[model samples]
Target: MKKKLLALLLLFFIGNFLAPPVGHADQWGVITIPPGKPIKIGMGTMLTGDYASMGIDIKHGAEMAIEKKGKILGHRVILQAEDDGCAGPPSVAIAEKMCNDPLVVGLIGYMCSGGSKPASDIHNKYKVVMISASSTALELTARGIPIFFRTCWNDKIQARRAAAFALSRKWTKVVVLHDKSDYGQSLAEDFAENIRQKGGKILAMEGLTRGDKDFTPVLTKIKPLRPQLIYFGGMAAEGVLVARQMKRVGLRKTHFMSDDGCYTEKDFIQAGGKATNGCYVTYAKEPDPEWVKEFESKYGPRQTFSPQAYDAATILMMAVERVAKKQADGTLIIGKKALRDAIADTKYNGITGEIAFDPYGDRSGSVVVVYKVVEEEGKRFFKQMAF
Candidate 1:
């Protein structure tokens, strides 16, 4: 009898160890937050690298939104920010770390599309919702990941609009360039497709490494193509280099245009100095003046996508408030699927404009604006141009 009992005890221990941990969660993926525990939101962004400015701006925006909301259902809301490195490998690691933490309810970012794409698979497996403020690659949503949502406009919309704007200006002969990143290459391809559909001539399509500074060779080759415009699909880090080297390669007469990746004044216009003058960039429409004033008062000089980040955080918190159930002992029980559904049904007016997500988790009614880099009072700034 003693030997039989020992065998039974061993079997029980093995079963318990092998089974999935559902101590604070239900079979339906409900996360239980004990009394006095704060609701944690994970933020994975580029905190260290060339794109740090954009990520820092996103962090500040989310911080402001959380501070204004104060608490959710008598529980303090906390943001756990992690540096995603704006690349694939770091993003996957961050996603794994955040998803494994039981306290982490949702996420706010994976700033670069290259990072977001791979990290998204991990988030979906854990049923963790992530809303991006800047990853604009169209394929990010095309995969039908229910947990992935973005406040940024799709690259297809921006590319089409840019092509139309270029055609309107009679800049038919153009060279398309990308930084070989998921975000940059996709945007360039879409823009090139749109240009072809609109009867514009694509002189040549080229790809470059992200961190490389020398683009004179490519520019020199393209200069002979006599393209009227060079549309670059990359961030300010490489955009500034390409713009500066164009002059050295004797492409001074070629017009330079880029996407929201190069929209910042400090990085693109200011960094490139005279090279960025008259350069055209595509970005989402500006937010409310009153809200901008309030944000600038605290954060000082907003970078791209801050407003979108604010709205993404605001929407997530609001969804959490709507779905979280408080138990008799003051514990909070939140169903992961319920929270995602609540966010999908969101229809709130945000500082950036009306907020609504489509079936594919893309923001509805997103407007892309074209701006020109110009010098005013000896300082370079982006001026909104009437398109």
Candidate 2:
């Protein structure tokens, strides 16, 4: 009996030694590799409603970046996304959720300026760093949110550029139409201010809301003013919609001008089949060669915000990689604060332009392009205007 008991004890000890500690096998994977936790980045954008097209473009770009970097980076990358709806309340709520999630170390966007600025406050409080791809409200940079950064230039720069481009072309009498949101109102205000400063006059100004299907009311109000050009500072969808409405109202003489929000190919075609002819908008045009080819091959001649959003995601990834510490198993772990500094210090060439940030987390040396929509082969093609 003593020998049998000794044998049982030996077997039990061997079993314990061979098996993983209780609950550890479940916590860790079967591979027994040291846990180099993957970086988690969150994204907030208007992935639905009227702005769905833009949101999809941004998402596609971001996803492509992750796919391209997944293998090369050693550690896996994960994305968590929520819809901000391009509004204030939803944006704040989404940002709050992302910042509160401990696993989420960084954020990519709230596509519109209205959404991004408010969310920046939430990110600041939580110490979560965020980078915006499309948000361009000047107030976003002015607030001095330390962790807030943007891949795209602000409305002030684009507005000033548009004004100069227009005046250079001698479109002195400019009318302005803006969406009621902060982005539209502020950009149009800046554009108008610049126009006045440059010895031009804003003959008329009009406003519209997010869901307004009929722009006839505003168009009629501005039609009689007869300005040399109409600058619409808002989204591409709204730009196209309003352009079509302007054509419908027999108000086609004035040249249509817009900000970066109106640069995409889809918006021009969606507004009306052929109404986009002669419309101009500011864009960041030098195509991202690395992504453009893959995107073109995947999307088949479709153009979208994939390049910009990809850059935003890539910047975040670079930041994380810079700060991550290798664990025993050769896995990496990065803290949020380190990630922010890495982002600020970044100087890599990105899909957009050089990925460098100014003091206020805005890109440096970024310039806007003015594109004129012209019909060719029964389709609208954006040609870079000389001005």
Candidate 3:
């Protein structure tokens, strides 16, 4: 009887030793970082192709934030960046790969809306958190993906603001154009709806391919309409081409307006030269001047979405710090659900503005600003106009 009792006791000790500790694996699972190991944050953006500069700017902004906060709970923070190609397929691949890695606690981007829309599903399935810096498609938040959030203003708000600005200027007869990408097409549709509802007339609504350089044909077809304004819903690559070709096709007097996509100096204003002057574009309001100066000093001239990216990264790190618990043996334990809840509850005062998230993971109280490209002292730059 004593031998049998001893055998039973030995089996109990071995089973308990092999089993996972009670708190280590929670309902949503937990991330365990052994001593001296780095905590990873994943970044997905278009590091190549036409929009490479924009993505590079976002990456730099996130890097700046990570560098500013040297470590989190005594563990070094490392950013693992992947190029999403600004398209659906590559973004899906990136999402799958990054979320599969247990070390990655959060994500910072999928710069374009087209990429973000599809990649969001993969992130949601894994319950990993992702915050985009520039993906502004309305449907992104509408789908109720709990893991996805954005620092940029939604296209619905931007479209309404753009339409209101145009109507206020009495440019009622307008032509709307889009690149047919997810971001451009949806924004163009919303703007058109707002214009019609506000008693404006749409002279023509057209779709253009993104990479095609020549827009003279489309401009020539619409020349006879003599619309007061042409609103192009696309990025800088196509935006610059359209602006330049509009002049060539004798639409010189027609006003040109666009969304945040073309709001860049190098790709739009400088590339379009005199054609871009006097044109209008809508983007988020200017960030704090001191913050801008510091960012420019560290990363050259700032691009369109760097400030938003900085805010996103900062907010993510803050949430990570909040939920991370240090173990007795120096191993860090982070509950995935706890981190998500903390992020959704974030109310941060960032360089951009007061940052907060709604239940849908959308940033609340975002402001959109209208800017005009003006020539001053023989150089071109964006001048903020009173909306």
Candidate 4:
């Protein structure tokens, strides 16, 4: 009996030693590497909605970068796309999903300010870095999340450029309209403040909701204001409606302008048709890279924000490749903090131009130029008219 008891104890000790501790096996499998598993990155953007075209454009740009690089560190790269719908709830859901993904090293987009604000909060929890292609809300940089970076310049810069252009064109009496969302409201405030400081007058400020199809009442009110310029701090989805309504309400002679919110040619020009002609937009300077021709060949013509998305993804992927630490078992161990540091220090000369970040994650050497939409050969096109 003594010998049997001793043998039983020995067996128990051997089992405990050979088997993994209680939850060890489960935990090991959680973050363990499959040597042949492809590295996955994610993109969060609008896949459905009026602004869906912009998100699709950004997606094309990211894939273009991946195609250019082929693979990162000899591992095949997979891109996972998520739809944030350019709004709050969608962004939160995507963020939570991305946080749960242990293999997703980084993210490429949250195209709008409303989406990026909440989504970034979730990313901070996992120390995952995200680079925005089109989000330009000033508060995003002010939020001070080190992991959040953007290829696009903040509205503060874009507003200054717009205000400067308006003043130069002698558009002194301006009426500002906003969509009340983070992106719209912040940009309206910035541009209005700049315009006032530079001796331009803000006659009236108005607000609009995202899905409102009617603006005749506000246009009627603003028509009497007789402002030289009607400035809209919103996307083209609503900008086109406002533009068409302005003309319908006998404000055709007035100047209609907006920030990059209406830079898209597809939605704004197509929907507004003749009304969008002569509308001014402030957009980043177009620096066509040689590879853009290649991208255009595979996917249709690049959208307004596509180039920025390309740079955002390429720089993030380059950072991932630069800092991926290899383990003894041939697994790439990408430390969250290390990847963040690499992005912060990124110096790649991307297709959009030289890419670098400020302490607040805003790109440096950014410039905005104004474009005037004109119809040529019965097709609307953006013509460069201002610096």
Candidate 5:
């Protein structure tokens, strides 16, 4: 009888241990695995085609962080990078593939704001956490998606800075030029509104297509306004062309200003050459000496959003590790919902600075840095200013 009672007790203990507690194990058993492989996060950005420089830098930054942290966020991490061609359908396709991939619980990239916005919608639909290293459209954050976030400041802050910079200089008459793309138009409208609110008058507003070469018509109309300043909201290609054309037409008195596109890339200098002098613009952030040292070791002397990109990947991975730690047997289970929750709650220091996303997936207290041009020996170098 004693031996039988002992055997029954052992059977009861084994049954209790094997049977998982109620709803969690049964409901989630199908999707669950025994902490299979390392957590995999998909990164989507423009690794090719135009604007590939920014994309390359973004990838380098993230890759550097992953290399330092090791794959396994305490377990292992896997990063799959996809190039979206920085356009419409290609970007959508990339996002769709990442969303469907079981291993890719989170995503980081699609630097273009237009691409980020559309891709983010798909990410949210599939409950995949996604973050941007460069997209700064205010509307991207205005909608309040729980899983969407950005490492850079939004267009609103940039527009406000531009308005304040122009207004403070007593430049009452201003001309606005944009590329007619979403980024350009959005920032132009915001800058216009802020300038008006701050008592600066907009003398004229014009736009050009992305690849349009001839700006004679737009410049001719804008010149008549005799504006003190010209705010061009477009990429470097058009911006440089506009500056050179304006110089040709003797609109030298009007100082030019642009947003991130002009500052972040080297195109404005390369395109306009000597003509890019005296132009002012805004940059995302200044590089830290220590971080630059590290970046130089990995990537050469190319300036890009390496720090922010690194942070975005690191934050997502950290969250995945957190989820893995809380598993039943310390198994690393990197599912979509778990990864999303981990990314959503990240509060850590990034390569640029402290990173803590607001409810709308926007970083709080992120300021836009303004820059001025100083040309030497036919080369352009931007001077950072605190405004």
Candidate 6:
């Protein structure tokens, strides 16, 4: 009798445990926050090292939006930042953390394309929605993930614009360099295609690993190529180092160009100093007339994509208010499906531009802007070019 009773007990426990977790939507990833509780929104971006300022500026932009919006469905909204250092492993860790937390309804960023590619898979596994602040890898949209969206423009049109800019400058002989990451490689390839289309010659194509401080070896090789333009498809940190080394390697007279990755003026100016002078960069857009006085009053200055980050956070907050359901006990419930739908259907005009998403989660409209690093009034900054 005792043996039979123990077997029956084992079967009972197994049946209950395997019953498929029967619960209301509140018990799922979307927690029903009671009144006075804060709704958590997660951030995945670099917060340390040479790239820390970009992510920190993005966080401040989101804070500015939250401050303006007040709250979400009567619950205070809070940002939970898990610095990923713009690398894959740390980004995955933050994605896991957000997935495990029931209150994290949506996320703001995975700033780097390499990080976003892998981290996006984890978000998909758990059905969490993420809108990126500064990731522009074309392959990300190629994946067709509904939950992934980006406020920044991708490399497609930007590459063409950059190619046109090079041709217009009569710098037909160009050397293309990339960091070998998803963002850098794709941008290089896309830009190369356009460069060829515009009848420009690619003198030499080279690849460098990210976080590589020494570019002298590569610089020595490319210097002899005598390319009219040397375009690096990488971020500001590496680009700055390369610009400084180009002078060291006797490539000082060559025109150096880069894409959005090298658009952070402050970092480039600080690191590259006079090396960045006459350097040309292309970006989707910059934050101007974007409540700059108010933003700088609180957060110092606008760096890189801070305005777009603000818009990304504001868009998420708006979606939260749109999809949140009020319960009888005064708690708010944000269902995963409803929030995703709200984001998919977004069409709000943001400070950066129109905040809309297409079927592939790409913005409906984007324009590439070019900048030239110049010194004016004893200050070095990127000056917007008309063409």
Candidate 5 wrong stretches, greater than 4 Å: 1-38, 73-76, 325-331, 376-379
lDDT of each: 0.92, 0.80, 0.91, 0.86, 0.77, 0.85
How far off is residue 141 in model 5, in Å?
A: 1.0
Question: Model 4: clashing residue pairs?
Answer: none
List TM-scores for all candidates, in order: 0.93, 0.87, 0.94, 0.90, 0.87, 0.91
**Residue 317 in candidate 4 has what lDDT?**
81
Across residues 30-114, which tens digit of lDDT does each residue of candidate 3 receive? Answer: 7777889989989998899998878888898899889889899999998899999888999999999988997899899898999
**Which 10-residue window in model 3 sums to the lowest lDDT?**
20-29
Best by lDDT: 1
Model with the higher lDDT, candidate 2 or 4: 4
Which residue runs of candidate 2 sit more than 4 Å off their true CA positions?
Answer: 1-37, 71-74, 300-303, 329-332
Which one wins by lDDT: 1 or 3?
1
RMSD of each: 3.7, 9.6, 5.5, 6.4, 8.4, 3.7
What digit string (tens of lDDT, one per residue) describes model 5 on residues 70-171?
Answer: 756345666788987666677688889988876675788877877887888888787777888888778989887777888888899999998898888888
Considering every candidate listed, which one attains the maximal TM-score? 3
Q: What TM-score quantifies how close candidate 3 is to the native fold?
A: 0.94
Compared with the true structure, model 5 gives a TM-score of 0.87
Model 4 C-alpha lDDT per residue in residues 265-305, reported as the tens digit of each score = 78887778888899999888776656778888899777778
Candidate 2 has a TM-score of 0.87
Tell me model 2's lDDT, rounded to 2 decimals. Answer: 0.80
Ranking by TM-score: 3, 1, 6, 4, 2, 5
* Clashes, model 4: 0
